[model samples]
Target: MQQVKAVVARAKGQPVEVTTINVPDPGPGEAVVKIQACGVCHTDLHYREGGINADFPFLLGHEASGVVEAVGDDVTSVAPGDFVVLNWRAVCGQCRACERGEPQYCFATHNATQKMTLAEGDDAGTELSPALGIGAFAEKTLVAAGQCTKVDPSARPAAVGLLGCGVMAGIGAAINTGAVGRGRSVAVIGCGGVGVAAIAGSALAGASPIIAVDIDAGKLETAKALGATHTVDSSTTDPVEAIKEICAQTYAGAEGADVVIEAVGRPETWKQAFYARDLAGTVVLVGVPTPDMTVPELPLIDVFGRGGALKSSWYGDCLPSRDFPMLVDLYQQGRLDLDAFVTEEIGIDDVEAAFAKMHDGGVLRSVVIL
Candidate 1:
């Protein structure tokens, strides 16, 4: 075991602390990673607020990139000195989803079998529940060997680390789940990190008339920089109408976009996405909702009349092994502006301040460089 400085959320609604924790050496099928960069995401904030569960003293931060330091006797996929992006979905290939050649939808994902523990103060020896099983806001962390996906070493760690979560979800929502393609019309509702990423992915895929909808004008501007052809301020205007008008202009006689992505995870916005797609279009929901939230009521006849698919995206339905390296290469080639998502670089001790800045419209991501 080794002690390292890490960020820990000891109780709900309390400030996070930078303290020491014990990371055990890799066991069978596990590996130890020396974290280089980790992004501050809303999900970490959710874990701090007890929104994920009652698992207090949670080790936060998941979107991370690192170098392999050590591996168990059975490990081979990655090795010491390899640069990697850590992922939560370490697939078990024997699962039914994998058997069907869809490991992206693998029902059984896993993390390290051994636990990291609090190494000091009153909470000494307490086992920590890692956020998404990746507790990466630290100098080092142990995880399942499969969680580490090898990527180009030359890629910037701060930029590519985001692929472990939100960015991947947004891009996947477009390219994979929505099947956005050349000349397709697309509308994205949100303009947050994930929403803007969807816009970028659509642009990369040659989608036309990419409409960005958000309440904040600043976020909409960021969306445009990332690839949105048009912007909609939904707080003052009707997004559905705007999307329809925009798509109709691009594709003759089209009622709306070919694909509508709901990235806000709100009922009203989701409703807008539901109605903002053309006939036989696709609606992909990549935003996460709270437990108390229920599905919005809509006419069953409307669902029948839509003649399209309504799908929820889980981690953008991505397979890290296949997608991470490809994306890193794209980033290296300057085709993907992965760096734009990083608003600022901060120290591990500044996580609380970063969390406070999460609501700022100008800030897309605050990355912690360890």
Candidate 2:
């Protein structure tokens, strides 16, 4: 066992307590990683708020970058001293989804088998539940070897780690899920981390007239810097009308954008994405919504009349083994500006404060440098 300091959410709606925990060595297919940096994302906040689930004393923090410290008896994917990104989707090849050749929908994803405990003296040991089975808020985390996606060693943890979640979600929404391609006019509504990443993905795929929509002016500016060729301030103007004007076609083009991505997970924004795109254009919803929330009702004819696909992207429909390293290479080549996603590098203790800043509408991402 190894004594490690980790950020522990002892209960829902409480400040995470930084305390020492006992992390046992990897067993079977698991591997122990010495975390160097982890990205603070909205999902982590959701986990802490119990919006995601009722898993208590959650060992919070995922979207992390680290080095393999040790391997279990059956481990083969990674070895000690290898730099890797920790991904939640550790696809099981035997699953029906994998057998059907869609590992992205893998029915069985692996996690740590051995428990990491919060030891209170000798007899009072409390087992900690790793957030998304990753809990990278600690100096060390135990995960399945399949969770470790090896990447270029030189990639910055603060930047590359973002690929583990939001960035991957947005990019994959366009590339993998939406199947966006050359010359397509895509509009992303939200202009946050995921939206901007969608813009980047559209640009990467040689898309044109990539429109960015958001209420925040600053985020729109950032979106343009990433790849958006046009900006629509949803608060200032009706995005549907603006997109119709932006991606004007010879036809009514009343439908406006070709591919509309709802990065803002609200009933209103989903409506915008539903209507903003051209007929038969794809709409991908990457934003996460709360339990109390529900998609607004729309006309049934509109659904059939739209003639396009409406899809939800979980982790960008990403298969970590394929996307992580590929994205790292693009970032290294300066094709993807990952560093722009990281607004600041903070300590794990600052996560609670970071959550408060999330609504501040300033920072894109606050990474925790362990």
What is each predicted model's overall lDDT from 0 to 1? Answer: 0.95, 0.89
Which tens-of-lDDT digit does each residue in 78-175 have in candidate 2?
Answer: 99999999999999999999999999999899998898988664433688889889999999999999999999999998899988888898999989
lDDT of 1 by residue, 95-116 (tens): 9999999999999998999999
Count residue pairs with overlapping backbones in model 2: 0
Candidate 1 local lDDT, residue 246:
92
Cα RMSDs of all predictions?
0.7, 1.6
Where is model 2 more than 4 Å wrong at Cα? 121-124, 249-254
Screening candidate 2 with a backbone cut-off below 3 angstroms (N, C-alpha, C), the clashing residue pairs are none
State in Å the error of residue 90, model 2: 0.3
Q: Give per-model TM-scores.
A: 0.99, 0.97
